[model samples]
Target: MRLEQQPLSQVPEKAYHLPAGTAAAHGYDLEVTPESAGWGYSGLRVVTLAAAEEHAFSTGDDEVVVVPLSGAVSVEADGSHLDLAGRADVFAGPTDFAYLPPGTTATLLSERGGRFALCTARTDRHLPVRYGAAADVPVELRGAGRSSRQVRNFGTPDHLDAGAIIACEVITPDGNWSSYPAHKHDEASATESELEEIYYFEIAAGPQGQPGLGFFRTSSSPGHPIEITEEVHDRDVVLVPFGWHGPAVAAPGHAMYYLNVMAGPPHPAAEAQGGRAWLISDHPDQTWIRSTWADEQVDPRLTGERS
Candidate 1:
């Protein structure tokens, strides 16, 4: 399935903001393929299964990582079997995952059903099937004060041995902001890499189990102008083909979590540098924000000092 690329001049206003259930297909709650996204790489799928149920698919030309959003899952691929000890929920902590190389058929079965995120990127390289332990993931607390957020670098270049996909998870406490300083990686140069990005979000509910919401923003960049500012909810996704995007803000009573998927062409200057680098340039006007973090302390909730 291929979709003709829409000229940037004619890109739809709402094309980047995919609301929950809007992109459902192939038995997945949400499916965003490179073809469907009008980009060359980066895709994501959110799937849910019942107890004892299974889902199977072929990797085709894309390498994939099976990340459990909730509950445990058993994965079988390329004659290899992996049991991911998933967490109770996203906020429960990092969960184990399975990486399936390209050109393989894989099956996922859960004794006690749950939701899973399939993060993918188109690539020609065929690596081996491997499992990533939750304990091995590097968790970083970035920024400070209201800008503080927790980042789970599970499938980043320095950590995982993969071809094109660079994925991770971020959690921003309620009323906080993340992905700040408004950065852009739309230009391929000595300082920046041109990568298309996908943000799949999940907001935590309020004390009474009320629905949660957050906000995301993206503004115009030099040659690639785009604009997006929307209230995002659980399962909502935002595509960043180009532009300066930042300050994903969690509402006053709702913490926000998002999975980031990115991929792009390799830099010619550094052929050995697999297409796994995440180089970005902060919006000049807001670059000064980084200096403020030196004086402020990280949010207590993220430092385990308080709940």
Candidate 2:
């Protein structure tokens, strides 16, 4: 990836689609900061540690959530210690997590080694450090048929109380699609909220352990026009500064998983509303797809049954 500064027109494609290892920084395999994204709030860092290894860092001005992608880990932050029971892989279901407020120092150690995702958001409000148990995460099955997907709401505004960040995980079965109907949240209004988003993906391997692949699309949205339709693989990332993004499709036999990190300024009309929310507007032409879901049965794979 080019590191030297260049005009957006000169590096537009590279700016949004980051292949594996292209965004690495600060000892992490993948790092996308608010500064790096040319945005103000959301960030994500992915790291893998060997058995008995330790990693430490200060939260600085960002409130962060430590999510394990695999293996177990123990986190110590703000005078508190918590053991996170992580999953075997992203396809293994939800895993516990730890939250650390800004300006705090923390350490993470894995007895058996693991891969972790640090989701962050720059904020002034300092909430207390806390642990989110895997069992407490709400898993919702959304859409139906080809659009069916599983959503694990762990750090979403309605689930975890944070200053600005809103996060969740989506699992789309092979040959299905998620993030459909093409939506945008690039405007701040009573019906929409402006939030920058980061999509970190992981594609489950094939039966013979071959690499997996998928696709992602982000198209123009009014004044905040942009476009990206790229083939994605394990550990790849897509950044949405402003645009309508959707139709993340997993190729046949390749299950897909993505961690979404989002954060933005509070809506002006929300001073009395008392909560940050994710409000979006779907593409007018594709909005009709939502109605079809009402008549279709959800894909059995997402209902805890084998496909």
Candidate 3:
């Protein structure tokens, strides 16, 4: 994998899209750091382990959530141990996750080989480690018609107990659109919040195990300089420091899964409040589509069934 500095004037697509082996290290299949992303907060690491393989790390100054993308695992953190009953894969359904506070050390062991995602964000607060059950995850079928998708709000601000970071996983069925209407969260105000987002994608294969593809777009906002529209595949990542991003569309015969990692500036005098929120401003031209979903039925694929 090549590691080089890129000028700020270049298109973001050139630096985004870290392929499968481009960022591997320390038993991780993919790793993205705040410094590597040229951002202040947000990071992700995907680790794959063989049966009985063990991996451990300390959070240092970043809080982290260990989410299983496939198979079950045992997590030991801050003197407490939790065995997570994970799912067969991302499309199987919502899996249990463990959140580790900043500065805590944790070890993960998978008796059965599987892939896991470490969603992280830098923060100064030291919250307690907690476990989230799959049953507790809210399965939201958002949008309608071709724009429909399933959102697993397992770690979103309104659902989880955390500081500084807000995360979620979205599943866009075949031929569907998600993150629609294009939206921006580049300004700090009552209507918008400044945030950095990480999109880690995994494309599902067809019934016969055929490869699939998808499309993603991010356009420059008022003063921010970033624009990209690219073809995406499994394990590809798109970093959004600032921009209007949307319309992540999955191609026919294949479903798409993307884990969204986001975090922004801490709230003023609300550091101890334990409340988290994300504000977005939709693109005026496409915002009207929001009214259309009211009459359309959500896609039947979002049946909220666990495999």
Candidate 4:
């Protein structure tokens, strides 16, 4: 039950993008605190819309999750049902994801400079919202090296894919270290529990911008460990649960882009689906991590999300 301490720039940027960790993302133009400032739920933040204004937002108490961690956009809640989508791993990667529920009152349309990562979850109730992403919902990337994949969304298959969300998109090579020892699904009593997490990062270097970003925290045991590898830019966020949540995002030759937003309270045998039942586990100490990264090679274009 940790990860309490938010303050990534105080949140207050109508049209702002300046958190340089990813070396001033060129085509990326980052933005990290939308509707969630350290987990409180204030003025409804998280903006990175490059040019296309129809302005009309309402929903201030929280309860929102408009995630699109990369490309595609076009929403219009109440504005007149005009949905267009792509993101959550390019519309289906890392286990498909996309939802904007709480009340409504929305309008976000992207022309071309689309690179999203918006997720709001506070809850109050806005009204008049929007979202549209029809056709081509076939994302596939079923594990290899470091695995766990399942994002199959067709058209609100049942909605509720996940909200106490623990997102993902990890590409760790170079020395390898993906979520080591550290463990804790927050805690929700029987039925699993405690889950309040968020970690956003995008790093790319190796032919020039070397030094890639790495190292994270939540450890002080199994031999006392607490380190934060300096060098992390591009929408930086480290809102972990508690101690023992180790080795997240490792880079030594560039190639690490993290996007993990999680929600807890389910799992532990409480039954009823048990959250997601650990999803997939076996990380006591893979001998130095990398348990099996043999050179790794998962990039079938890496963008369109397994089209």
lDDT of all the models against the reference?
Answer: 0.90, 0.88, 0.85, 0.45
- Which digits, one per residue and each the tens of the lDDT, describe model 3 over residues 1-307? 1123245445446686676578787668988888788767789999998999999998887899999999899999989999999999999998999999999989999998799999998888778888999999988888889999898988877688787788999999999999998998877877787677999999999888888899999888898777789898888888887889998999999899999998877654343445356878998889999899889988887876321
Best by lDDT: 1
Model 4, position 38: C-alpha lDDT score: 48
Give the 10-residue window scoring lowest on summed lDDT in candidate 3. 1-10
Ranking 1 against 3 by lDDT, winner:
1
Residues 52-136 of candidate 4 have per-residue lDDT tens digits of 6333454434335455555556666654555455553432343232455565566667665355555544433332343323344
Q: Could you tell me the lDDT of residue 297 within candidate 3?
A: 85
Model 2, span 1-307: residue lDDT tens: 1123223334466679999999999899999988788768889999899999999999999999999999999999979999999999999999999999999999999999999999999888788999999989889888889999999999887788888889999999999999998899988888999888999999999999999999999988888667789999999999888788998999999999999999888767655433467899999999999889878988888753222
Give the candidates in order of TM-score, highest first. Answer: 1, 2, 3, 4
Q: How many clashes in each structure?
A: 0, 0, 0, 53
Q: For candidate 4, what is the lDDT?
A: 0.45
What TM-score would each prediction reach against the true structure? 0.96, 0.94, 0.93, 0.30
Kindly report which residue stretches of model 4 are placed more than 4 angstroms away from their true locations once superposed: 1-64, 67-75, 80-99, 102-108, 117-181, 189-192, 196-205, 208-245, 266-307
Kindly give the stretch of ten consecutive residues in candidate 2 with the minimal lDDT sum.
1-10
By lDDT, rank the candidates, best first.
1, 2, 3, 4
